[model samples]
Structures are given as C-alpha cells and as structure tokens.
Target: MARGSLVPETAAHAATTVARATGHRAQVDVTSDGAALAALGRTPLLLRVTAFSMFVFPSSMVIKDIGAAGTVPMILSCLLFVFWLASWIWRLHDPVRVRHPGRMAGVFFVLGIIVSYTALYGGWTGDATVTGLAAADRWLILAFASLGLILVAAESVKTMADAMQLLRWLLAGAFFCGVVGLIQFTLRVNPMEWVQLAMPGFTYNGGDTPFQARGNLVRVAGSTFHSIEFGVVSAMLLPLSIWRALYDQRGQRWFHWLQTALLVFAVAATVSRSGTLASVVAIAVLLPFLPRIARQRTIAALPFVIIALFVAVPGFVGTITDALGADTSDPSIATRVNNYPRVARMIDAKPWFGVGPGNYTVQNAQEILDNQYLNTIVSMGIVGLICVFIYLVLPGVAALHSARHAAFPALRCLAGASAAGLAVAAVCSVTFDSLSFPTFALSYPLLVGLSGAIWIMVKNEGSSPAPATTTPQTTRMD
Candidate 1:
C-alpha cells in the first residue's frame, strides 16, 4: 500500500507487512514497537496539557491561595522541574539530543545573579513589603525553574514538529486570552471580579487591581492580574496568530484569520504602546520570509483594518492616539522617563554585582523604571545583563547559525518567528518589565526551550529518521 493510505489502525499492520515482506518477521515485534512509540509521540495531549497549564495557571482563580507561593504557575514550574529530573534519571529520551547550545552562557548568567545577590546581602535599605532575602529566594526559584524548562525541552523534545506543536497550543491559549480581553474592553467587565466572587477569600495583590486606564479610555486586563500583563500576552500572541493565518491553510483558514484579528484588536484595546509596538516588530520581521501572497494580502489589508477598528470601537482611535502620543504630560510616560537618571546611577554604583534580585523596587519605592535592561543592570548587574543576552538573543543566534548551515527550510520559519518574538519582547521590556509579569515571565523560557529544540532537530536531522507522514509540518502547512 502507498504511504498515504496507511491509517492509524493499519500503521502497526503496515509495519508488520513491511517486516514480513523483507523476510524479517524475527524483527516484526521491534518494528511494531517503534511504530507504536512514533504514533504516541505525535499525540497532542502532552503539548496541550503543558501549554494550557503554563498559560492559564497564572490566573488568581487557578491558585489555591492568595500569596505568590500559591500561584499555579509557580507550582507548575516546580512540577516541570521534577519532570525534567525524572526524565534525566530514567533516560526517557536522548540525554544530549536537544542540548541548550547556550548552556555555558546560562551558567554564567546564573552565577552572575548569585554573585550580585550575595554581594548585596544585608545591604538592602529600602522599605519593601518583603525582606531582601525573601525577594532573592523568589527570584532564584523562578530562575531555576526557567532553567529546568529549557532542559526539559532539550532532553525530551526530539524534533522540530514537537517544538512547533507546543507553540501552537500556546497560541491557542493566547487566543482565549485575546477573546477575554476583547470582552473586557467592550463591556468593561472585570474577569477578576468574577474570579474573586466565585473563589471566596481570594485576595488580589494591590498591583493586581481589575482596572487600568490611559487618558480617557479604560484598558483591557483580560484574566491576567493587570492590563499590562494582558497587553503583553496579547502582544506575544499577535505574531503567532499572524504566522498561523499566513501559513496554516489547511482546515478552517478563516478561523485562523479571525484569530489573527482578535489578537490585533486585543492589543489595541489594551492601549499599550509597548505591546502594540512589539506586535508590529514581530510582524515586520515575520513578513519577509512568508509566502509572497500571504505577505502582500496581510499588508494590503492593514489600512482597512485600522479604519474599521476606529469606526467600530468606541475610543479605539483616541486610546491609541493618547498611548503613542508624545505628551510627557501623561503621568505614566513622564514617570518612566523621569526615573531613568536614578536607575542609571544605581547601575553605575553596582557595575559588576547588582543591588540583588529584588532591591530596585524597594530602593526606588516611588519610581517605576519601565526599562528592562536598566532593571536587569540595577537588579542583577552586568552579569545578569549577559544572561539576558544569552537566553533572549541566542535564539536569533541559533536561527542565524541554522540559516548559514543550510538547516531545514521549515526551521527557517520557526527561527524567524522565534527571533521576531524575542525581539518584540525585548522592545516591550524597554517600556514595561515584560519579564516581571507571570505570563510574560513564563513565556520567555518556554520560547527559549522551543528555539533550542528546533535548532537541535535541524542540527541532528542528517542522522535522524525521515519525518513521519503524519508530521505536523506535513499536515498543517506546505
């Protein structure tokens, strides 16, 4: 039978047939086992559970209690760490198959953070609600968990298909976030209020308030703790939705297109210039490599989409106008700008070791320094800055490496998306600490893992078995 004719039920039978035809019945059971494992690997449940947990678990409703310690993402991160450890012990997958090429860089980054934090031990002078040691411990826990995620992908994910599958699920979660954000924007409905009502005794951090605004328009916070969190989540989703709309032309193509629009509208409604800018950057980088027809159609429709958005949504245009406006009179913008000098001085004082992981907010209690780079420098010092470069910038580094090495053509798209996503995130970080929010924070390591996984597949493809006919790449796109 032809390869395409083989269904799941026949897959084992087909394997047996092939073995029998080759007079290798003695090896038939082995062949069947391999085929079964292959089929199991292609199952979507693992990706779905992992992605959904990562995306949705950060909500207050998902937490068992009010404190950061009780948050679902934190618990999930620990579980992910345990999973990685188990995988390591059981030799569940090739130990070195999906190595984080930036492992050395990661070590340096972590060391830098430790040294910085240790250097500032007992030196904290700020009035933080939490002690410096406690803050440092929280930061360390997150850092280690982020590292585990990278390692998990490295050890378990064996192909480009697996990496992209996780990405698809993440995009699905992002779509849900976008939909909720749209409702919040349209009706001014607070999902947090609903969560609070349903889950009694659930308290919100002062920072996790239900409403935020820019000028005269109320921003959409979605199910996340804050509007900026929702904006950043939407920003990250925007590119993936566009990539899906442009590429995946199989089933329900219009649905993908609608997903793309919802993500765009979600970003706009948040009235966040950084988030909107990040989406634009991702799309800009993504456009060049796309099939020509998709590129042109998407670009051509932009003007009409913008016009329709303004006409249909109340305060849409004005919200965007006020957001991007050069009005230093805008309190948020002014505060962010005015505080730069103080951050610069802080960084200068601790050029090597930073003022510890959680010192900045306490030290500069009244000021909100929106810049992530500055935040890193002051918080973790130059070493922390280097770590940021390794994780965030190295994906693009791997992408460029693959491009030069003539990796798989499909990998080019994944690399481009990864590079663009990270770039957009870096830009967003400059306006708001993108890595500080739970959703955005978790997203970074997840994407990093995906990037590393893709590079590993491309790097090892020459020796690996040819992709199955049921591979996602084969089914989802050309």
Candidate 2:
C-alpha cells in the first residue's frame, strides 16, 4: 500500500513539473513573437518612403535628365518592386498569410499588360515620338512598379498599429496637399515654386501656371499635375480623414477634424466637377455605415459647410454647380462624348488585345480619350480592360467584406473608409484618365494596398486564437 501511494505521488509531481515547464516555454514563445511583431510595427518604412515621395515632392518635379520616368515616386516604386521581389525570393516573413483577391487581380492585370504588349511586338505603328516598343516597355515598367507598391504596402501591415500608422501618414500627406492648395487658391502662389528655389536639379513640368481660374474662383492644383487631379485625390482621401476624426484614439481628435475640413476645402478650391462627384460618392458610401450620432452630425454639418465654402471661396459653389450642369456641347463634355465612337472603332481592330499599352497617344489618336475605361480598352484591349475593372473593383469589395467580418470596431471603420476611398477612385476614373496623372495614380495604388492590408488583418484576427496580451501577437503558434 505504501509503495502504490508513493508511485501515484511521484507521477503527480512529474505531471506538475511538465505542466510548469510547458507554460514557461509558451510564455517565452509569446514574448519572442511579440518582439517580432513589435519589430514589424516599426517597419512601415516602405510606406513612409512611398508616401513622402508621392505627397511631399511636387508631382511635376522630375529628374533633370530623365523626364517623366524619373519622377521620385516612379523611381521609388521601381526600387520597391525590386525589394519586394527579393524578399519573396528569400522567403522573408510576411504577416499577410492569405492571397488577397485584389493582389491577385493586380498580378493578373500586369500579366495581361505583358501579354498584350508581347502579342503586338513588331506590328505596332504610332505617331508619338516614342516608338511603340519603347512606349510599351515604359507602360510595362509602370505596371510592375504599381504592382510592387500594392504588394509591399499590403505586406507592410502586421498589426492594427501598423495600419493606423499608414493611415496617419496618408492623412498627413493629404493635409499637406490641402494646405498647399489653400495657399495657392488664396495667395495665388505655388509653394512648389518656392520648393524649387530651395532645391535645384528638379524642374516643374506641370504647366505654365499652378493656379487657374474657373469663373471667379481660383483653382488650385496643389502639388499635383492639375487642379482636377488635386481635387480628385483630396476627395478620395476625405473619407479616411473623416474616419480618423471620428474613431481615432491617438492624439487630439480635433486635429483630425481639422484635416477633414481642409480636404473638403481643397476639393472645392479645384472647382472640378469630377472632384465634386467623387466627394459626394465617397460621403454617400460612408454615410450608411457611420454610427447614428456621427451620421446625424454629418447631416447637420452639411448646410454649415456649404455656407462656409460659399463664404470663404465666394464663387466656389456656383462654379461646381455650373460645371456639373454644363451642356454636352461644352468642350470637355463634347470631347469625352466624341471619344466613344473612336475608341469603339479602335477596339474593333484588335478587340482581344487592341494596340499595345501606351500606343494610343494623343498624336496617334488625334485627341486624348480622357476616360481611363476607354483608354484601357484602346490600349490593352478587352482582356486588359477586364483586368483593370477587376483590379479597381476587387479591393473595395474585399475591404467591405473585411468590414463585415471584423471583430474590432476600429478595423471596421478603417475598412469602410478604405472602401469609400476606392469607390471614389472608381467613380472618378470615368471622368478623367486617373492613371495618367501622377498624384491620382500613386494615391490610388496606395489605397488599394491599404485596403488589402485591412482585409488581411481582419482575416488574420478572425482566424487566429485570441491574443494572450495586447502587445502584438503573431498569427501562428508552435
């Protein structure tokens, strides 16, 4: 009896010892994982670099020797793509484990561009200074770089903190552009001129003037290539600013609200119908998902905001109204309408792949299409246009899906905001060749990447076990 009792006690002691050892090991593992994530949280370095290149430098600024291809954002994007490829090849740890549909669509879109370009390799003819082959190569480079930005941006977000940091940087960029627009609109001065004076080896190629007039209102381009581009980008970013203002726990909320107001004013300063439409679309998309109080507040503020715009920029409201109500005979409206038959004819020739990408220059076509949808069809044909549609539409859909499934309210708000921004991009694409403008082109891809990042986070959170502690958890456990 004594021997049996001793045996049971020894067994119990060994079991307790093993349990304690396992718990200690787990604690160490969690700590190490937390450390790794914390490290990741600090490495939104690529995002910051990309944002700075996109927003801080004048969109018109290009390398003195390299022209359009030498723009800082373009160069950075290419480098980023190389880095992304190297990381993948080396099997670096990526927080986003799942293959997001948006990312896949982007890849397929790039492939489609290559295929289209390859199919028409030797038979292309165009009136542009750049040869068909050279133009196709440039377009392919841009496509790869854009895809690189999306991939890197999507992979950069390892935690909610990283996501917030990215949003904050984007908001800051928008705020900077807003302030520049305000200065240009009110003071009739281009801050980029001053920027140029302060720095040499950069040339501004936007246009003869940074400020233009629409009726009695001064139109501001800010740092973008055109006032329309500036306005559209501001409108697209407005939803994220609103989200930050409403839900962000970091810093003073009033500051974010101020940013939101600045973005709205910037959009109005452009006196662009497309910008106005984009802003309205974004707000409409966001309104349904907002909290009741927030929705009510937005509704209540509309009249006051309109009044303020009218008061501050005297002819702003009327200018937008007039532009929207402009007749089909209006030059811009007529140009877009006239391009349809031309584009349709061009599409009929190749239909499947059309002419190679970037071959549909103004010199060849006799006029710019101005509509990205039509432009894609003319340049890349039906397959490329389908890819473009999927690339543009899937991110927003995925983001909304993430919002619906997100466990955290903040994540849901972010997803909703991203979706709203993407909606603006899609709606604005029809009004202008958004991809032709540096600011909108870069900004759109960033939004796509961010939406993808949000989708990954939401999915990761939903599928993984509850974190042991709030200090950043890894998706996997050993």
Error of 2 at 445 (Å): 1.3
Task: Write candidate 2's Cα lDDT for 28-141 as tens digits.
Answer: 111222432333233245446667657767756767676666677787777666666654444443424546766886787688788788766745423334577677877787
TM-score per candidate, chains pooled: 0.80, 0.84
Q: lDDT of each model, Cα atoms only?
A: 0.60, 0.71
Q: Best by lDDT, which number?
A: 2
lDDT of 2 at 413: 65
What TM-score would you give candidate 1 relative to the actual structure?
A: 0.80
Give one digit per residue, the lDDT tens place, for model 1 in 232-338: 66766665566555445244878887877877777777777876787788788776655455567769988998897887677778777766876788777788778
- Candidate 1's C-alpha runs over 4 A off are 1-47, 59-66, 90-94, 102-109, 121-130, 196-206, 246-251, 362-366, 400-409, 462-478
